[model samples]
Target: MSVVLLALSASLLFLPGLVIGLAAGLRGWLLAAGAPVLTYGMTGVLGPLAPALGLRWSPWVLLGGTALFALALAVIRGRLAEPERVWTRSKHLVVAGSVTLAAGVGVGLLFFASKGFSAIPQFWDAIFHGNAVRFIADSGDSAPSGLNVIAQPAAQNYFYPNGYHLLVATVHQFGAGTVVQALNAMNALLIGVFALSMTALLRTLRVRAAIVAVAAVLCCAFTGFPYDLLTWGPLYPYATGVALLPAALALVVRALDAPRPALVAVTALALVGLTAIHPSVSIAAAVFGLGLLAQRWLTARRVPPGELLTLALLAAGALALGIAHVLGTLSAAGGPAYDWAVQRGVPEALGRLVFFTRSFDEPQWWLILPFVIGVLAFRRLLPLLWLLVASLGFGLLSVGAAAYEGPWVALLTAPWWNDEWRLAALYLLAVVPVTALGLVTVLDLVRRPLPRRIGLVAAALSVLLFGYLSNGLYHQRNGNRLAITFGGGPTVTELEQQAMNHLAGLVRPGEIVFNDAQDGSPWMWALTGVRPAFGHALAGTEGDGLGKERPLLRERFHAYDTDPEVRAAAKALGVRFVFIGQGFVTGSQKRAPGLVELDKVRSLRVVYQNPDAKIYQLTEPDGQRPADQPGKTPPGGPVVVSSSPVKPKPTSSTPS
Candidate 1:
């Protein structure tokens, strides 16, 4: 039942955008692929606007706003005409079959890889993202302008993109499932969106139907994308932006090809959505757009003045935004200078780029054959070739940053925080269509010597053979990564989560649980509706306004009976309980200073205990139980503090 709701909730992301796209005169695949782009655009706009308009942020707002916008567009365009017959029955079937095949691969990969709908990713960023969704749901404020309040309640005018959070929060509010379930659903949805959008772009480029179909499936074959991003940082928002990018580029192509005002307007809106989701991916889309424009200028005998003007304006606008972003003028929370040390030598990095492998992952050597075939057989497709080269070149420079830290590399890579994973994902996006073309080229060569029906059978067998050789879209390796990311470690375990659920029932409303953030305590609010004093691992220590109080509690909370400051801080924050988990997020046995030896703290009493976790309620100065939590105890009798703390065995593996 939860899984069904999750699927339904994710499908809701397309409704508003579909309505708007139909009103804007978009047709066929353009309407189908472009809807999610517009959905995100609405999220980006309405997330911040809802608060200012004195309206609560909800899916209803998005739906109502979309209706209004679509109505306005229809009014401006004069009238809604009858839908055009854009494709024949056969072509429609081909498109549907291709998109479904690709979406099935993507959704299947995510479903099994993630273990289950309720499992939470244990990566560092997941801590913040999970809590952020809960924060938005609880506070009724989805604005990026104030989202940092999750970490620091006193934060003012901070900015981080909230479009991803808004969508997940919408899912949670609609009763899809828990916050973790909604997160997994959103991830699956983004993967499907990526496949659909990439297919639309291939069709827009006039690729043959056969190639388009193969390319859609190929989009999920690369390990560097949609999968790696899911494991490494679990970079959900960045993934969402990349998923929308192909459609945004397709819109750009459509607008430039015909130069209509409505097309240009819709293209601009899509870009806005892309930017709000992830600025770095927006930069990538801009680069691809510029490359396309350059190709047009060099190839066309005569370019229309309007098209040329649009190209110039786009370039200028991109430049202006880039400048503002680099100067830290775009938001109150300035862009971070992410400096990841080089993980490979130049030779190895270049080899990985050729195989579409990010970092030390297994290389897909099979991709090279088709890539070479496509380049050699279809040399006339210069734009595709150019994009392929550009993506590879950028990926090489990014992955080999330590070997080549020139000013140009710094300028080009800064927007992505100099991260190679992001650059590699972009390269994977380019690889899909080219690789599909190469596969089709091979099929053509084989088909020329055979009868029509036999040739079709051979082609089908060949595709199946390719999939078999690719290990069903590299499922085993990706599934293992997902398992490790979502499974038990020091960050969380089944027993620990069970204890968290138990703790939820013991606490009253409006009380905070004092806990070690590194022990996955940050997930408490999202999973159990029990607020933790520290919302993130680095929250109190990293200028999140908790200041001396958090540090004092971290070091001396177990000393509450003897330390006035610790007791005072606990009282001030309304902390009624202390939770101790099995181990640290890094899988270390070292406990937080204040959380250790809590069984010896006379001013605290064990309210709950399990093999992997323990919860203690703050007691009165005279060692009496607190008045608020009356009669909450273990199964048989009154609670008793153990003489010694229980130590559970810790897992060795850490989150990636």
Candidate 2:
């Protein structure tokens, strides 16, 4: 099954991507103008279908799919004309190409960063929360976690978007799960391609813009100015969004600025592509579309009725998708339910302003100066400024940094973490615009010698600082050491060999392992061949906003805080085996009276004990198995997993 999933993942990504590319040729106009919308809509459609396409392929599948897609594209070549390249003066050509190459490498570096560059673990959430494996194990097949604005919230309920998973699953063919090296290579490649696309777009801009473009690319690669500010591992969805957003924006510029069916089609397709990257990026594209239209209107003596219609329809389509996703979640089991804090009072809104509170939070050190200059230089950049303004307003309004406190507000505006050291994702809200501003600002200051270089230097320093942090995390996880021992030793995922070996002794085919501040490590590396009974869960699904399930999950957690209830529940569910982890007081048995620690489980045999884990067996053998166990292999067919793990009942702590 894992093998098949890998093959299918490949087909889904490159194969369909080719079809989408070809679609650009025939429905050239539709594809161009609707790129974001189509991608967004298709995600909803394909997401649910991904699991049912039980067929997984191999590298052979990749080869065939690649060939087939290439053939289809070639066949459509006659139907598609080359987009008119912006004419460049002879003096600027060489410089432009050089700058373009620089940009590509710079962006590639950023992409490399995503592949576990920082001290932060790559695929942190998926591994710890166990969402990726959980859903796959639970549903028997991976399904879409995100269906866009139109998917019933119920439909997206079980899934949360994770870009790496989609790619890994395709080649995995057998749900081989995520591979750090493979994902790193893949993202590096994606960054390269995405950068190339941007370079092409920049070629059309002033040559001066090209040189500055390298800096912009560098900002993305090296600076905390925005995109580089994540600590929660790699942000697959957000980075993909940033990568694709530029392409979509370029198409829009071409479509609107060039004013031809070809360009219009290009813009449409870009819009659809925007939709595919992530709903937020799509929404941002729509905003870009509006900006284009507004600029057109302002420049024109009169506003064209058609442009208005186009914007209206484009927004409406995006809106429709949003509605569908929400509706779907409402109906699905484990759907995200965010209805608890609708009219969140003024006090709560003020709390969300802190940016550096969670796992990924860092002082916006390099971001500080450029942002000041950007504000000074482009007071007129209303859209970008609005992002800042909104973030500030949201922070001012939140009572504290509670999740539900400002999800609706964040939904209206992008969520900003005031203190993100450990929890959450590296969203593009700050990165994209900040990169744009830094690039633009650095471009203006290129000829200027001293203080001018300060921004770039600060930017570089910022990258090094954050990169050190993020990269350190990645290295710690992917490091080659067998085991470094304690705090000074094999950190985070860089678990010592001895600890892992110790776990292997105690863990059987299907057992629950609860460990440490970070929970997903065991599943990603330790339980690769077997199913885990229980692991960690994520508290941050607020990206869905005002979700009901979040509240339920919270309630369940509170109720189960006592070891007695959690243990009884685990036992009832046939989780007789337990692996207690380090860095956390994970023992549900801790809350129960007269309950012994797994380490001291005299009644139940101690199977394995390490610095990182303590594996234990239940005192009663009957408690180990259940009529219907989660990870157990029954006499029937093999288990098929879905992509969307049931969104943990958000508020209830209730097991799904």
Candidate 3:
């Protein structure tokens, strides 16, 4: 039943591609293969356009947009004529087999790993992404601007693309079950996209059918990405973005090779979609495009002027539309929030490439060893070698604060290569195909005496060995090693959910609730619809000309139970309640002064209490301040009140 719902949601997501594919006369798997890229691109384009027209993003809006886009294509082409696609029976079987393998492994793993997603995210950023999805679903506001409204109204997460969250919100809006189910379904769809996109791209590159099937399976087999990331930081957005990237690039490559107006249009949309999904993908696309162009020029000895002109025009249009968001992202780079002091040397960066010393679940060197050999074996793959060099160069440069870390270098690596792990996804994009080719190369060497099935079996065994040797074949769950575990990470406790439900009924919509960091307030907003006063994402709240207000609010939250001034500040900030969950006093701040003061404060009346958490109400009847006690002043006396408002710097979106 869950699988059926997931399939329907995936079909809805593929609607845009279906229309585009029909209009383009694409046949077979290629017809819907371009869906992920087109949807991503259109979603990004729509986000900025939606709010401007006074309409929030919705499934109906996307449907209408896709309809209009298809209509435009039909009008341009003057008819709906299907293009001829010639293929042999064996080729057809191979394509079918590739898709089946991808769907089985991709969707199967996603379904298993995300079983508990319906409740709460067990990872860190799940809080932010989940809440963002709910915000869009509830408010119908999918605008790229004003996204971080949980902290400051003016804040936007332009640094991170909103396409993934936008897609998830759309799924939740139309799906039968909870937001978690929608998210889980979307994750499954993305995995399918990741695998099929690679298969489609391999087909475009004219790789053999048998190899394509192996590549599709390998896409899901890699434990480093599309799997490990599911638990570690729960990098859902990045995962989705990377999945769509190959499809976008494939469309561009095909378009450039054969310059039809429709193909160019699709290519432009694909690039925009890549950018909308994640800036890193867009960067990788540029590198791939340039490498392909260089390879083409070297081989053909001439440039396709028509194709180049079309690409230039499309790029100009996309840039004009997204320049503000682009500029904002650039300015926010290297801000204190994204800076890391740890020095990662070349050896460590290389370790990151092989997933060595990265995590207990990191991939082994064997998985990538064949990919390296394949690149070296084929002269035609030299351009790919250049692409790999460019990717690795930027990745290495991203780790240190050398002369290369200046603005010039940052312009190339910001938001994508800012972390080495991110580049791993891009590396896999190339490595998957190389690995496939390498396996095929090995099979060719033994074809004289060995049977074809035996070679296929050997390829499968090699991948299994890679997983086993990496220690990723099994995962730690409940302090025990388990095989075939659906996903990694802890599930949300029932006690926490019950407490949140109780608190949700007491607090009015959009009410401010001061919550302890250790209590997981950062991620609870999606479930409760109550705004958090402070969390890791909302660190300083020192932006929008109200910077000084954050400190005042923070000080008030800690001393609200005792200081009249603190209570006054709370009223000014519109804070109504304080939630102290079980883990509130267990961290580094267990002995902090604020924790001590909060424990002893007498004014807070307990509104709700359980083994898991306690909620305290700070309001009184008639909204009058309590009379100041004569001895209420501590040894340092009353805090001085300032008359002027302090301007706060906007919070940075760089990952901590």
Candidate 4:
């Protein structure tokens, strides 16, 4: 199933790209670069259109839709002018193949470093991210109104971005692996796409082939910036969004140079794709697109209406589709959800100009001096320079320094950019290109006769140093050493996993489970399609201005079983089972007192128990117990049973 999905997804990416390339008359490497753009553009369109057309939003649907569209494109291309020499010569294939192979190696190494693909990413975000994909895939609805099916205060459905979930869910449905595995596969493909896109972006900028290769090496070799997002996030959507930026920008640059209608459409579509994955990147795209459009108009003394119209349409469409997410974010814009203390002052921030966080394994100190020198040497690369400065500025602002904190802080860094770790990704987007360009510029200096040998030596040394800095072998080698770690570490132990599986088998789908807020409750929906009372509050699904779910969530943890509010909230939420264990406690379990009181409540019965966990069935507070269970105990101490591994039969129909 994984192989079929890989092949189908590859075709979806390449076939559309091939058709678009042929129609646009792209040559050599440009053709290869254009495919990813086309693939993303098509998926962006498919995400919104699938729900509208009454189609299920699974990988099969996505594959069918993309394949059909690609076929249509091929038919159209056949009627167009005789195709240009796409291969041009065998060397083009070699160059393209080699770049692809190199990218494959990078992705493969990262995959193993992260550990063999599983259904859940070991990152904290995976609790919600994995569940969101499961929700969209199972529900067949990616509409903003249809999200928040698992957590309380369902309004968050409008807040979280659906693009990454939509893509992954669609792929998971067609793929043979679990949702997490599908996500990993997509990540690998996008990483490769990003590498190819970077090469294409340099090529579009008219950088020499040798220089482009150097830049490609610099871009792909860095484990700190972009690859760090993989381990750090495992930020699935944001990572995908950043990966597409280079491709979108490359197309934009091409459009600026020639202003063809096809180029304009392609650029617009690519930008939309970026919006789907991460709005921050989309925001960046808007700024760059407008800036470039303005520059071209200034140079020509007139606007290219075709390009202008395309940009306007894209801007308008994105605003329309994302209005819910934007409005939801703005409504809650008092401050960040968590405290992000100032980590450093100006000096430290400046030091971070070259130093990266999270890539503890590889430190690229050797490239800093050359990078600064290259920046001065390549003054013509103004766009990348400006982007680098802007990205760095945002990173500094995220630190929440006293001098940097004011009305502007909230206004500027709300929702997405508030976290410095997230802002690091933007830094990568700007810095990778600048570093590559700088290194290439420095390398070009020694191409003279007397200095050629010195230049060769310098290049070799630079490669060696950068290679050491960019390598992830050390991290990969020690991957399983940690007992419990964060950011793609082993979050769940074997005992916990067995417990969760046991609980899932006992509970029916769509039934609410009154579990601890801090533990595996967050992942119940993702794991078994069952709803939990609450997860970690800082994780932000409950206790908000969104809806009534927060109050119910609170009652679940703090209210006594005999409390009318508890019963009412449980009834309203349709909770049938209460699960308890150390898995429910992380940091501190605020409801430990309530849990104690629950044991005394006569209306509850212990149905299942293990050394690490227990499951309880809730009898109706009004004396109407489930028909399957005998009324052996009155309104006294709750009947407690210690049993071996056992499975409970299904109960009456419960609304999901």
Task: Judge candidate 3 at residue 185 and give its lDDT.
Answer: 73
lDDT of 1: 0.72
Regions more than 4 Å wrong, model 2: 1-19, 22-45, 52-82, 89-140, 145-157, 162-164, 171-178, 186-208, 225-229, 255-277, 308-527, 540-572, 584-596, 619-656
Q: What is the lDDT of residue 525 in candidate 4?
A: 64
Candidate-wise lDDT, in order? 0.72, 0.39, 0.60, 0.57
Q: Per-residue lDDT for 1-656 in model 3, tens only?
A: 58666866787678777786667545565556787778776787777678889998898888787788767666665433333246688877776776677666566555555553353545445666777787788899877654656445434343446777787788778756666677777776665777788776666666667677767766755655666555445677777777877677667667666656666666676677767766666777777777767877777788878767867866875675456445545655534434333445656656666553343444445556666667766564553554556655644553432223456545544555345556555666766767766766665665535678886676667556655764442222211211122222122344555556666776766566766544455455676666666533333323652334445655455666556677676666576677665432112223223434454456555656555555666534322235534345322123222233322222211122
Q: Find the candidate with the highest lDDT and give its number.
A: 1
Say which candidate scores most in TM-score: 1
Which tens-of-lDDT digit does each residue in 1-656 have in candidate 1?
A: 55685566657678778887888788778788999888877776677678879988777887888888788767655443334335667876876787787677666666776666667787667877888888787777866756564566545545677777887888888776889888887787766788789877876776677777777777766777777777767788898888788888887887677555455556666776776677777778878876777777778766669887876665454344233222322653353455565666787777777776553466776777887777677663555655676677667656656345656766677777667777778877767877877898888877768999998888888878977887876666656656666665557767777778878877778988898878877778888878888777662225545556777898888889888888889988888888887756664435778888988889887776766778887877667654545445532235433444344544645333
TM-score per candidate: 0.89, 0.58, 0.82, 0.79
State the local distance difference test value for candidate 3: 0.60
List, residue by residue over 136-244, the lDDT tens digit for candidate 4. Answer: 8788887544555544444543444576677667666664667667666666576567767777776666555554565555555545445666655456677777666
**Model 3, residue pairs in steric clash:** 41-273, 113-486, 113-487, 542-648, 542-649, 543-649, 547-648
Candidate 4 error regions (>4 Å): 1-31, 67-98, 156-159, 231-234, 294-339, 358-363, 380-403, 441-491, 535-550, 556-560, 581-602, 609-612, 620-656
* Candidate 3 deviant stretches above 4 angstroms: 78-86, 154-160, 320-337, 355-357, 361-366, 380-389, 394-412, 450-492, 535-548, 561-565, 583-597, 620-656
Which of the two, 2 or 4, has more lDDT? 4
* Native-to-model Cα distance after best TM-score fit, residue 484 in candidate 1, in Å: 2.7
User: Candidate 4: deviation at residue 621, Å?
Assistant: 7.1
- Between prediction 2 and prediction 3, which has the larger TM-score? 3
For candidate 3, the per-residue lDDT at 639 reads 28
The total number of steric clashes, by the backbone 3 Å criterion, in model 2 comes to: 154
State residue 632's C-alpha deviation in candidate 4, in Å: 8.8
